[model samples]
Target chain A: MNGVHDLGGSDGHGPINPEPNEPVFHAEWEKRVFGMFLPVAACGYFNLDEFRHAIERMGAPSYLNTSYYEHWLHAFETLLVEKGALSAAELAARQQQIAEEAR
Target chain B: MASSAHTRPLSEVEIRVKALESLLVEKGLIDLAAVDALIDKYEHKVGPRNGARVVARAWVDPAYKARLLSHGTEAIAELGYTGMQGEDMVVVENTPEVHNVLVCTLCSCYPWPTLGLPPVWYKSAPYRSRVVIDPRGVLQEFGLQLPESTEVRVWDSTSEVRYMVLPERPPGTEHLSEDELAALVTRDAMIGVTKVSA
Candidate 1:
């Protein structure tokens, strides 16, 4: 499926802000997400295309608001549910735990 | 006493990753240890520095540059950098007459081995969508201002192939050695979002 992830020449996205001495990753969560996404992806539930499509499959509000790795995070949830490894209810509960803990 | 890691709450993505990782690991679907190692490799090793080495080598060796432009995979593999998403590499050279920039209109199909993980902007919706439509305007945003006579070619990478930009070597830098030249090559230069200069 051609998703929003494919942004080859549309418009309205803003300027690119580059950092001096940029690091490979900025945050700890980013690293964990990348590590998990890549290996689980290699585990064969879906090919690269399927994985990307899962990201594309996200609702517009969530997709537009999410960061890059957040897209990967949402995709992980989507793939797990789609592949029968997870359920929407379970993901919702996990998200709730963090939300409640932060309260 | 607990470490700082415990005091700080994980981000939403981090929390989800932890939850998913535990679930996946419990199902015997993935090896957490191995995943950690892979992240370490990308974080510490196999980064833009690796691509910088390639750019530097090409700058010093004309034949190698020719081979790189013609057979990107083999030339890159010669440097011992080869893997998924980069198996079919296409090295486009940025010259005085033409400038080459890379974007994955479909998704961020970047060369992981050479450039490491793409920048946030590379994966952001704006960069993905805007670069192809108005490369000159986008170039201006990236601080690259090319003359009208110079052609800006934006390569839209598909799943079949990935691309890397070979930036033009700046003038008066001939005295620098191959390693030094490579040192000057930035990831943006390689992506054709910017240039390499002294």
Candidate 2:
């Protein structure tokens, strides 16, 4: 079997190359949401001060479990529902409308 | 940091914010240069030095390394840097025998507290898939050549948690102080592609 590095190239095996300096929508959102939700998430779940202390303690990970965009989507969805900005039913309805519109 | 108020997807709030940005560009409520300046300011001021300090400390102190492995964030705060992106972190250590590497396989889960923003490569799918399977080869591309006997461990970062690598300290630095040790801790070392050198 080919190693992981061998997977991205023109033959549809390797990873596709993105344009240099391209602005990524997902990453932009991830950075925004990370900055926004981290404080609240830390305070409500883990101890706020302790949480900050822990983060400065390590280096980068080998892999991320979810896409950066997913984190933004997750945080946004959670906060929207929590703050009554959008009800679960409304979200479901909007998703259905979008899906139907696509069809 | 702003409150978690704009989390919803495709909502009116986000649209309004975008619209406002556009309007500011059109009507000059805010200059584009000023906005760019603000972004740069935060990116630099709140970036990953805190995490780098932790990695540097672990390199110099064995006991601190033990503490970092057990309780990463708390261990880091012992050095007096706290708040923001560092609320949650996990420490993965590398040794001469077993090298630890980091990749954001899914998207770009990074230890923002220490490292600041994830580099563009970390967020790319190619780096994510390639690193986990052929870490030695990837390291080679990054100008790192490891022995075959060195085992590679790849950690996957998630939304709830982040990770950082504690690279082994290089030789010829026994006489160096902690501040000197910190200088040797390059961003690549913390990512596990390179080791600290004299």
Candidate 3:
């Protein structure tokens, strides 16, 4: 099996020579997105009876348009706010504080 | 008991959910073990193996190939693997005559039903930007050296659609059963970076 970094590069030729010690944030993000979807899995979204029909109707265009994390984050954020688990103001405040700390 | 200094600090939302789940566990509303089992079930059973099965079936059966080309999801569903992630999937066939590759140019719009999850590289900005312009180069980086005469086509997956490659059956293995054929089908083969071989 080809490793994740084993795909794509310049030259249309040569073996994958990834930079050593380079952060794998991109790959890590993919796993994190999958982790975020664990709740959906637990909620029976992946069961044969529930999501099968929906999966059959999903289009390629929409799937490609959204990022892995964006999908989970969108669902989680929306549901949390709707269920009163989180408020818009609290989320905004947390985001602002994180941004401020970064600066 | 006081909270330990080494305890992890969770976000407010995380804390709330954790508390809720703990309450459920205490009240027997849900079993923690069951949650762990459910997660394990999907993570292991519902991933790239599905795509591998489809690709392998296409390799051995001409009828299945026709069905896959015309209706990939329905054909895949015939294998008892149907649902949302596989819903918008398109199966691009690679023949000795033509090679097909898949990519999500914008983000990683993977066929979760079939592929379970998109690999990190598939979602990375570097891949999205570089794959379309230099597909051959990208394949080469994957240690796949195709003949210059072979044409390479890249399908960009989107929010509504996902793609999987139906790799051509390699020669020298005529007697292999369906399961054996599936074993030869790797994730990279489905991605067009590598060919399935016995």
Candidate 4:
């Protein structure tokens, strides 16, 4: 899948800004998203290729705008729904519940 | 109850993740405890320190160096850094005349078992897009100015195979122990963005 994620030779993004003393994860949410990979993987819902493909399938703007772990989160949601492990409606309902709880 | 100092509203993505996690747990599709253990493994048990040990060992032992370059996955596993993204590895050696750097042009396919998770800059669009076309320029931006004569080799990692740079040992550290050598090896050095100093 040729997408913005395949950013090999294309240019004009900007100067690389390597942060000083960067942590492994920037946010707790990012950590949760990172941790989700192995266990979700253990369920055998989708393989690594499918996982990467799901991320690649993101629209160019969304893919580029989102953070690194957001990409992982996107893949998890996309694959789970696509694989019948979870339905989109259920995920949406859960999201609503969580958003309400947070508020 | 008032929100504590540490408490804040979760980001939209965070809310989404929390929602997904809880639902997955409810459906018995994933284990929360297993997720915590995985986080612990990445946060503490595994990291670039593992790769530093490998680089330090190779610096001290020529035999190990040969093994690492030729049979990367096995040599690395001998040191007990094997699994996941590091299952198939290629350890590229940097030398006086040649410098090696790695990037996953397609995606962030790094040797996680060795170097742990990649830094943010590694996954950013700028580094990924520019490094392959203008290696010398990118290296220069990293403050690693090579001689005009030094060849810059840029390795683009794939899903199956990953690359790590075996940075050349710096001079004037003959008395340094292997542990000391490991301490000098930084994540960026292993990533080939910078050189390990004595």
Candidate 5:
């Protein structure tokens, strides 16, 4: 599906501002999430292509607005639930628990 | 930084990923230790330095360079940089008349073993969307200005194959050893976003 992720040769994306000497992972949490990607995918929840497709399917506005790993996390959720490894209800409940804990 | 529109935490994706990770681990769909190993590999054992060594070896050894150009995956694996995104590596050289810049277009498909994870901009809509149509303009933004006559080939990685740019070595460096040459090879040069400086 030709989703929003295919932005090659388009416009309105400003500059490619590169940080001099970027760290492998920006933060500890980023590392954790980034780390989770390959293992979960390796479990047969979804192949690499489906995960990429899921990121592409993130809907243009949201796709452009979200961060890179956020896209990954979203795709992970979409596939996990779609593949029956987890359900939307369970995910929502987890989110609720997280929200309450944060308060 | 503040989270994106949808909040997951200060990082936006952290807590959600943790949530997903815990559930997956609980269900035996994934293992935390394996995930740690994956991160450790990319974070410590692999990176642009590995790619720099490859480029430097190609710079010094003609035979190795030929082998690299002909069979990138095998040549790269020769140096032990072989894994997920490194499976189908294609080495593109930047010559006086041509430059090769890579973009996934669809998603941030990158050669992880050699390049490590891509920078945020590499996975950004701006780089992805504009690089193909306006290669020169994008290169200019990256502070790389080429002659008007030069050819810019935008390798839109629409598949599993990944590309690495062999930047033209700078002049006046005959005394430098392979390690010294490797030190001069920047990640941006390998990505074709900038030139390797002294």
Candidate 6:
């Protein structure tokens, strides 16, 4: 897939600013997303390539704008729904519920 | 942050992740203990220190260096760093005449079992796209000005093979022990953006 994620040889993105004393994760949610990787993969929802492809399949706008763990979150959402592990509706409903609870 | 767009709030992402995790847990697809264990291992136990140790040993042992250069995965496994993204490894050595660097232009494919999760910049578009086309320029941006005599080699990691730079052992380190030598190896050096300084 010739998605925006294949950024090789492209230009005009800007300078690479390396962070000093960067943490392992930027946010708690990122930690949660990272933690979920092995468990989800262990249960056989998706393989590594499938997971990468899910990320690659993301829309260009969001793919470039979102954080790294957000990409992982997107992959889990995309693959789990596509793999029949959960329905899209169920994911939406759960997301809504989580949003409400947070408020 | 370089751009305002990069500063998007994490709340929405948090909500989405929470929802996904809750659903997975409810369906018995996720194990909380396993998740915790993985986090602890990555956050505390495993990291670039593993790769540093490997580089240090290779610097001291000629036979090990030969083996590491020839059979990266097996040699790295000898030091207990093998699995996941690191299953297929290639250790590129930096010498006086040649320098090497690693990147995954397509995605953030890194050696997790060895170097741990990559930094944010390594996964970002700027570093990915620019490095391949302008290796010397990007290396300059990293404050690593190479002489015209040195040839730069950039290895873009594919899904199958990951790369780690075996940085040249700096001068005046002959007295240092392997452990002490490992202490001098930084993550950036192993990634070949910068040299290991004594």
- Measured against the true two-chain complex, the DockQ scores of the candidates, in the order shown, are 0.56, 0.09, 0.10, 0.74, 0.58, 0.58
Model 1 score (lDDT):
0.84
Question: How big is the positional error of residue A78 in model 6, measured in Å on the Cα after superposition?
Answer: 1.2
Error of 4 at A93 (Å): 1.5
- Which scores greater on lDDT, model 1 or model 6? 6
Which tens-of-lDDT digit does each residue in B5-114 have in candidate 2? 75334543344234323432453334555555445545666455566678777867789989999998899779775564567878888887888888765445676657
Per-model clash counts, in order, read: 6, 26, 27, 0, 5, 0
Better of 2 and 6 by lDDT: 6
Q: If candidate 4 were superposed on the true structure by all CA atoms, what would the RMSD be? A: 1.5
lDDT of 6 at B35: 92
Per-residue lDDT over B15-132 for candidate 1, one digit per residue giving the tens place of the 0 to 100 score: 7777777777878988979889988998988788888989988989999999999999999999999997788999999999999999887767899999998888787777778888
| Candidate 3 off by > 4 Å | A1-85, A88-103, B1-38
Runs of candidate 6 exceeding 4 Å displacement: B1-10
Lowest summed lDDT window (length 10), candidate 2 chain B: B15-24
For residues B1-198, what per-residue lDDT tens digits would candidate 6 score against the true structure? 122555443377777887888898899888889998888888888889999999999999999999999999999999999888898999999999999998999998888877998999999999999999999999998899999999999999988999999999999999999999999999999999999999
lDDT, each prediction? 0.84, 0.59, 0.62, 0.90, 0.83, 0.90
User: Best candidate per TM-score, number?
Assistant: 4
Expressed as tens digits, the lDDT of each residue in B1-198 for candidate 3 is: 224666444543334334344433453445665656545555567777888888778878899989999898889889888776577768888977688888765445678777775665666556665777787877887778888889899987766777888888889878989888888877778878778878
Candidates, ranked, TM-score: 4, 6, 5, 1, 3, 2
lDDT, residue A67, model 2: 45
Candidate that would win on DockQ = 4
How does candidate 5 score on lDDT? Answer: 0.83
User: Deviation in angstroms for B141 in model 5?
Assistant: 1.2
List runs of model 4 lying over 4 Å from the truth.
B1-6
